[model samples]
Target chain A: MKYRFNTSTMSEWKIAVLFLGYVLATILAPTTAAENILNEESARSASEQQKLGAYLTRAGNCMGCHTAQGGQPFAGGRRLSTSFGIFVTPNITPDKEAGIGSWSEEDFWQALHQGKSRDGRLLYPAFPYTEYTKVTRQDANAIFAYLQSLPAVSQINPPSDIRFPYNFRPLLSIWRALYFKQGIYTPDQSKSAEWNRGAYLVQGLGHCNACHTNRNLLGASEEDTLTGGRIMGVNWYAPSLISRLEVSSGDWTIEEITELLATGISKRAVASGPMATIIRQSLQHLSIEDIRAMAVYLKSIAENNNDDTSGTLVPVISENMKEQFAQGRKLYDTYCQECHGVSGEGVAGIYPPLAGNRSVIMASPLNTIRTVLNGGFPATTAANPRPYGMPPFQQILRDGEIALVVSFIRNAWGNSGSWVTALEVDRSKSGER
Target chain B: MMHFILLITFLLITPVANAAKSVPDTIAERVKACTICHDNEDKIERHAYYPRIAGKPQDYLFNQLRHFRDGRRHYQPMAILLENMSDKYMLEIAGYFSTLPLSFPPPEQVSIQPDEIKLAKQLIHSGYPARDIPACSACHGDTLMGIAPSIPGLLGLSRAYITAQFGSWRNGGSMRGQVSTCMSEIAKKLTDDEVNAVTKWLAAQPVSTQPGSISVLSPALTNRCSNIVLGEHTK
Candidate 1:
């Protein structure tokens, strides 16, 4: 080394420090950047999951059943009347002492998928866990996260007033063995994604079959899930979904079905009774795509292909029966003709048409009889806020008169359906399915 | 020849009797049918929301029937009933109800406070000049018994019915004819409180024993009502 300042050495030392700093940055920069990126990704996913959970909650109408009338939303105190007894829905809000606040994601998944509580206790079918059992774990977890985000409502769950034997929670395990199938919705590879999604919603979260399916004495749904059934305790008949002679018959276009679902009113029909409630609380809030998917799934179900010989078996009016038809005709003119129209072509968008109407000429006259007796009021929704209501003839018309008028509406104009007897009318009046 | 004449006479008399029996039966049946919903003797008010159509002015009844038929009124039942009926038939039906000697029941006790009653009375009698609200009694006779040939009496109607009618009018529920309805124009000016007040006051009024005579004075109508013109029927 020369005594004079060596510029090259100084430059070399400076280069060495710069190289060390670069190496350090290469090691440390990624750790910090990756951490930030991972954090951002997780936060984004959490929000997305929450948004989906909110949508799913709305689709299932959780607030409608969970929350009591005029009570805090999701602070479940609503009394749901059932054959088993009254079920006071549980608080699903995130309250540590009162609600599902302490429930982990796995615990939430178990409740929804296995129909069991966090403590491994069997849950009641009244919670519609039979339907919720088909919900995906991801969806269940998302719902849990969304619920946890809500302000913790410290409302205590009220005990159910269930009758004996059914009240035993242990017995529910046996019931679950018989009725409940624990599994996430398996997408059918052969079907479109939309169709599968619709199927999942209709058969699972929507639990349409809960009301629409016929239940045996054991409360298990019949093999044909959506072929129609009488709602237990509720006097309404959920019409057959797959029959050619009922509502949602092959005659309906997909648009019509979606329209009915979204707006609660279509050119063909209006949603009334329990169906109206479904439309108002759940279906209307869904996206058009979801509704169309549901419509597609519903329409794909085969129409009742059994060659209906009943169409050929039109009842010949006897002299005595002629008097009944005349009376029915007079009654229709006096009470019904003003709204239903002269030729049974109801005012478009206001009154449902009777001529060639599926509800009018359905294979089972039960729904028509119920509608006439109870009066069909279309659900009030955003689309049709002030719906026209059909006045109930229960007070005004006798059982015989109701039967006669029902028979007349069924057979009037282009409509052709089996005659409803006075005894049938009486049975319906007495709340028999 | 005498036997032939007797046979012809018998045929003529038989046909006449049958026609007489059937025509009256049809019209009478129709009229009697209305009483099912319109007339309930037990209740203080005849019906809950259904107005007592009996004893209304012939022209007023006819106009309402026309309005229902023509899509001016929002009632489905009335519209459907009148949809296919001829104007002549509507006129006959309106004439029949008008001539029926029906007595109005006394007003039911309203549930509003004294101040509310005073406000209602002011609106009905004096009206709020600041808001250009003509007194309800201005067109409806001085007693609110309504003028003949057009104006419907506000008395004897239930509070609900009055309130509903006002609401409907304000919301374009009565959108018939080439001209805007006078009721529609009048109803739009009313605040919610004014509507409640007027309906309460109007519904509480007792029906005068005598039917309101047609007003002779031609007061300048604030609004042009196509359906309200005397003797001028739309369709």
Candidate 2:
């Protein structure tokens, strides 16, 4: 028998074994490929439930919507307004039938991903699943697990009052097909792994573009617009995040940028309004890597570094600004000196030198005028306080005179800015006393 | 001339005193202790540690003054000055203080930790590329100080506040969590080492004196580290 064995036989045997290995691998890979799969029995455990709870906290945007009117801290019920319709919030207290007492993890993930009710009906976009679609299957399952663990609420969500075309639920499939790109983010290999990871989290899981970037009529993102956009109802413009530098000028450094994300107060900016809510809650609590990913993605964007000088087409100024430098020079000499100093250095730290203040010479002249009109006080903290401030000239000078003093401010102390015209003063439309 | 006079008349009668109303009637009566260190023309000394605060927001000033009065704030004569004052007087002092101007300081040699600079740049320009975090400048402004009064400035602040607050937020020490909770989410995500690095970078950067012209921030903030240059996609 050994004499009968040939070289060809051995080669054939090797090939057969190779084929068998490939077959086994193909069969096993799919089952493993599916991410976030959980055994029903194992998921019922408590530790898993808590982990799922964290996932839900991120996915449900639970805190953002559940918050009550007066900072009652996620007590539920904030009005959600949309172009398609208005959805009154339904309380999700842990009551028996009203909430998800009867819901299974299968049911919850379906509700989120498919936008279907437990009974199998479509949900509206007011729930923000358009952004939530990127959550992985396992994540969705975990979130479901967490929600099921919560005490079921008896509060039934009031039906959304969507007008006309929005009232139809089946129409969503087409919209989803057109606008929703569903699937887990595959890391792009060409870029740095971290950059790719950032892209995934931001474009996929985090869906930062939903708020930070601009959107078109169908709510589709305007591809060209990155971080600059207009947030409706909030009465604010979410400024551009393109430049690696600070767009608002206070010369913010990178560390300050990170601190702002984590603590809401950087040297140049303080978190307030809606963004404050986000910092105090969702974004600030993310894992460190996630924050880093976001920072990388944002900084990567190219900024419109050139100054937008269009706002000054009509350089509005005041009569007082014109007159003060021309006439009030004596007034300035008398009262302003001892404090402001002859050189306009104005006791550094005690008093901010007026020569180069942003409120004085930035492209947007509104702040400088308003600060003078309204008068301002700098914030002090555990770090430093007892800061210096400026006097309001709103009363002593005429608009022209105010204009002159402002002109002096714009011109003097090494300050070189567009001249303050009387037109600028009249344009302020002040809310000051 | 008649229109000019009319505008002046309206302004004079517009009750300008109300604008700086938070200030006391007399400088002697408000922030008398502040002058002790701040009044010096040197632009250095004890005042040097403190950033210039003139023309800052009234709300910002008021908040700090209250912090001083309540002993929530640390640092110099401010706490001592605010110690015995009533909230009203404290607010007045804040108002009075806020009216002053900021001047360019003589440059200080800042110490930059190599790792801190690396992490700070990573966090600022792009977040941890591997994680899903967004850049801090996304909403905070690229410079980290915001735009206008609407956006705050980061140029002249103490780095200690920047670092401490970040740590507190990461562990959930803020005024409780809210949806717009920017810092906490980001902080909680940062590694302890990364946090230290960011703090070092922030503290190391030179503070700019030019008020509105933050044109220099871009160059100063972009940290060039070797690991980041590898260009591998974040997994």
Candidate 3:
């Protein structure tokens, strides 16, 4: 009880001991998969099997992918398009024909690891064998067990529509040879158990890089380009997740982040659009450990310092804008000045101002015009638990009136969005984009 | 083990039992038209976004409708078609949706690039060691099964949606209250390749990524309110 230890000395001793233990373990650790497992007949219990199913759910992101564009949750057929091509997801029900009902656990493993079908034919790489190949056969088998336990439903599989060379299935095998490596998720024994857990989910199940990482012309992701991935046909740009590379949030705690991912609702931001579905269907069902793992891993990226919040497009006071200012000012004063302040700050959580919003002056202005005419909404997050949306003015406002409203907001206050015509709104509504 | 099962069973049934209390004695006047598209047993196939609503948490579903009403989440069809809706009616709709049992359909197997998978996995498993990208599983879960009431499941999400979201965060998209915007911060730290790699890996993973319910820590992860992109809703 009277022992006293110096902080520096204690730290030095701990470091030395850790290094010694690492060196010792490195030489004594088993060399291969064969050396790891002593038995093959072990079966997961009902409880274990259920937990295993939960594990597989996180690993596969089942609800996020399998759910159709507007179809049943986890029922496949959401069309995904990339520079390479488009692929429609398949169903996972136990149906003998339409679903994976006929496949064995071995077949499931093959498809995941080797990208090969139950009959031995190569499966398309879109199935994510690249990452899944890292999962252990034991884990894969557990997922299979969970699948077998579900009720079977018959839903016909859909064919893909990727263009030309992208349509070639055999070519994926060639690609696999270069990238796919079959094995269990290996934990870096040198790292902490927490770090290892993070690795398991990110690499094995969460698959965060698939969206955050940038790809080359051949659709290969470049290492340095992580968190800077290419944007698809939509005007959407995937942000970087490497905090060392950039910072995207003004402030976010580890716990706040986990809660956001779990419920799609947090004090900072609410999940919206496609992400809403992902949260409601996919991440929300994840276990507390997995949520923590995701949070821990994301928090580890705190070094990134890129904040493009007020990047550009803040409406400048220009000669032309000055010229149109009078007309626009009169319009605003007559129609909008009553509820909206002359400064256009807008009511909190009720009316959003155009001052510093990128979405307002975005290159594509559909959301703006549409919002003006149709009056859409924001999603529910903890910050603004109950939001008040704007009502559509299509019935009350004429086309020119809508145009004037849009143009004013686009250029008003600090807003820098370009002028928009009623015709542009009409074009967008007609599906030109 | 029995206790766990019993607890879950009770959790599942308690909400429905409470829902039954709200029904009016006059069955005809208190119509259940909402059940047509919101039933737990039926398969909603017309549109994939229309999630099967049965068996969901009543509070969660109600929050969504209120979100739609508040204009945080858009639902043109709902407002234009169901405008004049009362707060009570919206809550009623949410109650009906919370009764559906989750049913997963078969998955479609697609192909992908090997090199893409390679880079994606590298980032996913360990993150960019050179840059400090944390693994995705830290918060989402190793199994990715979400906890109850508030947390969402990560299994079976569409890669396109996932990628799009990360893109939104990168490009500075706003979500509810701006609290959950941490993902945007996390995404901002990633390189383009990391996004693509993670998205591709997620899309390609085996179906039903997780097996059963994953525990959740909603209160722990979603309490902050800094980064307010929009102070108020715009008219």
Candidate of highest TM-score: 1
Cα lDDT of model 2 by residue, B1-235, tens digit = 9999999998765443432443344555234335534442554433344555655544455655554443334332343333323355465655666566654343345676666677778887788646756665643456565433222345454455466656556655333233113445667788888877666665555654443433232332222211111212211
| Model 2 lDDT, residue A151, Cα | 58
Name the DockQ score for candidate 2.
0.02
Evaluate model 1 with DockQ and give the value: 0.02
Cα miss at B2, model 1 (Å)? 71
Off by over 4 Å in 3: A1-44, A69-75, A81-86, A134-138, A177-192, A214-217, A221-235, A242-250, A302-317, A322-433, B1-235
TM-scores of the candidates in the order shown: 0.62, 0.44, 0.49
Stretches > 4 Å off in candidate 2: A1-49, A55-61, A70-75, A90-96, A114-122, A168-174, A223-225, A243-254, A302-433, B1-235
Worst 10 residues of 3 chain A by lDDT: A33-42
Better candidate number, 1 or 2, judged by DockQ:
1
Candidate 1's residue-wise lDDT over A1-433, tens digit each?
0112467989899778657765675688957755665587679879988888988887888877788643678989878776788889989999999888998999988888887889999888777778888787767778888888888899997788998878877887778778777776777889887888788888778888788878777677754368888887667788889877677546678888889999888866877766776786788888888888889889888474657654677677789877877888998998888767788876556667899888788777877887777664465566765455566566467888899999889888868888889899877754421
Q: Least lDDT summed over 10 consecutive residues: which range in candidate 2 chain B?
A: B225-234
Q: What is the C-alpha lDDT of each candidate?
A: 0.74, 0.52, 0.56
Identify the runs in model 1 with alpha carbons over 4 angstroms from their true place: A1-37, A304-308, A395-400, A421-433, B1-105, B108-235
| C-alpha RMSD in Å of predicted model 3 compared with the true structure | 24.4
